[model samples]
Target: MSLPTVRTVADLRAQVAAWRGQGLRVALVPTMGALHDGHLTLVRRGRALADKVVASVFVNPTQFGPSEDFARYPRDEGGDAAKLASAGCDLLFAPDVSVMYPDGFATSIDVGPVTRRWEGAFRPGHFNGVATVVTKLLLQGLPDVALFGEKDYQQLQTIRRLVRDLDIPVSIEGVPTVREADGLALSSRNAYLTAEQRAVAASLNRVLRDVVERVRAEPGTVADAVAAGERALLAAGFDAVDYLAVVDVASLEPLERLDGPARVVCTARLGKTRLLDNFPV
Candidate 1:
């Protein structure tokens, strides 16, 4: 397991191209540092599927809103390096801000339509940054498959659409949402919560599950069920509500009825931490 540092795009491309030329399949696990079991799970899955794994632990500032905690988003390069190395990652592309975004950079990969709802609507330019950075990473890493966690449900779908519509040559694989014992969806933002806030945060995940169960067992319209779930979470001491949507998993369009498979998604603030979670119905 080698932990070679690649500071520029060309440097990384050369290394990846050399390995790929030798008939080795490469995999890329992109992340925003603060490596946890959730992130490690993605790397492990990549290793299982590829001969050489490249994990890019970059925290892109362009993704964060002005008021958002771009400065405070957790990052630990040494720790991340060790984690990736032990997880059998061959290369770690942890570049600096200037390295990834030099001066006079005007390009953006905005996947419209599907990117205009849910998380995208709430966080403007967030998905644009995601799409742009991901396109660059895919072009730079050129892995056969890129594994993404299902916790960012809308995001996973967006990536799939972007890859398909744009004719990117990489495959998109989704990992299921990792959860806490009490069923809190694992998130990097979870580290921002206070002890009490964390307890109250469990309401979001529970509400989604409740919506699915209630919809299936009790049978109701989407609005009726979404309202019920919202009330329960609001009563549980959440600070502010974002949205609670039941959507088609394939297209991410809001659903009117729970006739078949759907995703119950929610996002809200428990103090400063913005938590997002979804469950399949």
Candidate 2:
């Protein structure tokens, strides 16, 4: 069965308002809509946490760079709505670009420092687009809780910061990064990889896991572990290694030594696809 979809803010709010009027809690799972197992996991989680689940499927042009894959990003509303229905999602808000950003739309939200490194550094103005669109989604749906996959760890953190700083009045929940049996983190962009490239992709997570293990076994070797991890990725057939660092999990600042909680975060390019994965240290 196809899930009910709404395109305009008016219809979205009216439906949500009806649910809220009955004292039902709503949860929003925002996605770019190439619907996969990882995305379905989020929808299931939203259903578990609230009386109704809303999954938004907007490609969010603002988040894509001029040279990025915005034009070619996979989109299938009919297929996605079917998948959402199977996952127990109550509504699908698949808005058109014009509906999301009207003629006079001219504001952007910057979450600052949390978005300064890694994905942000590589794809400039990316987080500004993310923060803005997310803020809009949270406000438009006015969900009691918003669920995001930790697969985009930095993006998750950026959203949390924006909600707290802006006082958005919604609980932000981070779901764990869902991965394949071999450990490759699930991503919409994974569709870009060839069979050979797909096989090589799982090594990215293995390298990060090894780095985290090394850090735990020898806290002083954080820098050494990071450098070694980068070399391992290149040797494992990755075209380039963007960064591999031990960062304070909360603040995302590079850590010289492991004093408190930390994470090993990395981004590497395999052919044309960039793979991101992080492990707790």
Candidate 3:
């Protein structure tokens, strides 16, 4: 039998705590309410790792800047619930923003230096919001494990670091990014792309792939390789290139030279939407 979903911090915890009393290991898939295959993969991973699953569908307004597309971010609660139910999600916590931030919910988690790099520097206050909401969800869900896909690899890194630093009790799982047949990383923002832009969105991943390949084959300086990637995006139709840098895979520090276990990370704006993709080198 499928488990029923519950909303709110109190009711949701009551249900999961009851399951835990019966020795059930629970896992969670936290999302912003767009139930794509990438998200389903996280849910499936949660199901495989634990007896019960919780998928939180909150778009998170704080994570969006005033200039960003917060108000226009598509939200389909009925459809999201149906998809989560069909994807074998045991519980869906679709919290109302009012319920989440009711009055003075100002406490936030800050990662200091690590959060200040890349995505953070590009979009101020973004990771602080992510860190806060995720912490809140983890506390509410109290799952034995949590699944986050590799598509948002940097966010994955940030979550992992936060968990370690704060001694959060959940194991963070990093699953592979599910992509389109043409190699575009799956994302809700893909919905914002026009047909013309959709054809080039995959260029994000393609450029990252090329950079990785070049780093491996030609053995150029890391700087040279990342510059080549930025050039690739401009040629492929990105309106603006935000950043394309090679950094240490483990530390995430910018690699000033050819080195070991580096990741080529990029952020670009297509039309009004900002996209990020990375590949291991």
Candidate 4:
């Protein structure tokens, strides 16, 4: 059966209000559609956390740069709804851009420092889009808990900080990243990869894992390990290495050595698709 979907905030609130009246807890999973196992995993986690699960499918134009693939970003609401139903999602808040931003929407949320490096630096104004929309979603649904995938570790941390800083009432939880058997972190954008590029993309995880192993063996050689990881990506057929470094997991600051909890995060481009993957050390 197809899941119930709400487009406007009024309808969404009405439905959620009905759920609340029944004393049922709600969990939310936000996505840009083009459903995959990774996204479904989040929905499933929501099922486990709350009595009702709401998944939002909005491409979020603000998060995309002028040169970014906003125009071509994959979206399939019918397909996404079917998948969500199978995954046990209770509601689908698939709002259109107008419904979300309206004609006079002017605000953008900017979570400081956390939005200053890595994905933030490479894609300026990206997290502002994320912060704004996610805040709107959380407020709109007022869910008891919100679930996010840890595949985008930096994003998960950024959201966590924003919720804490803004004093949002919902609990923010992160589900572990789901990966392909070959180790490629699944992403909606992975649909853009050509067959040859797909094969090369799997190496991203393998390389990050290797970097983590090397750093674990010799913490002082962090710089050398990351540099070699970038070189390895380039030699493995990736066109460009955007940024590859070890960052403190919580603060996301670049770490000189792995004296504390750290993550080896990287972003490399194969043709036009930018692949992101991280490993812990």
TM-score of each: 0.96, 0.99, 0.96, 0.98
lDDT of 2 by residue, 76-194 (tens): 88899999999999999988899999999999999999999989999999999999999999999999999999888899889989999999989999998889999999999999999
Find the number of clashing residue pairs for candidate 3.
0
Q: After superposition, how far is residue 159 of candidate 3 from its true place, in Å?
A: 0.8
lDDT against the true structure, each candidate: 0.87, 0.93, 0.86, 0.93
Model 3 whole-model lDDT (C-alpha atoms): 0.86
What's the C-alpha lDDT at position 234 in model 3? Answer: 86
**Ten-residue stretch with the least lDDT total in model 2:** 271-280
The Cα RMSD of model 1 versus the native structure comes to: 1.4
Clashes of each: 0, 0, 0, 0
lDDT-wise, the better of 1 and 4 is 4
Residue pairs clashing in model 3 are: none
Residue-wise lDDT of candidate 1 within 120-232, one digit each (tens)?
A: 88899999999999998898788999989998988898899999988999988899887888889888889898899988987788888889987777555788899988888
For residues 1-281, what per-residue lDDT tens digits would candidate 4 score against the true structure? 87999999999999999999999999999999998999999998998889999999999999999999999999889999999999999999998899898899999889999889999999999999999999999999999999988888889999999999999999999888899999999999999999999999999999999999999999999999999998899999899999999999888999888899999888999888999988778
Question: Higher-lDDT candidate among 1 and 3?
Answer: 1
**What residue pairs clash in candidate 4, if any at all?**
none
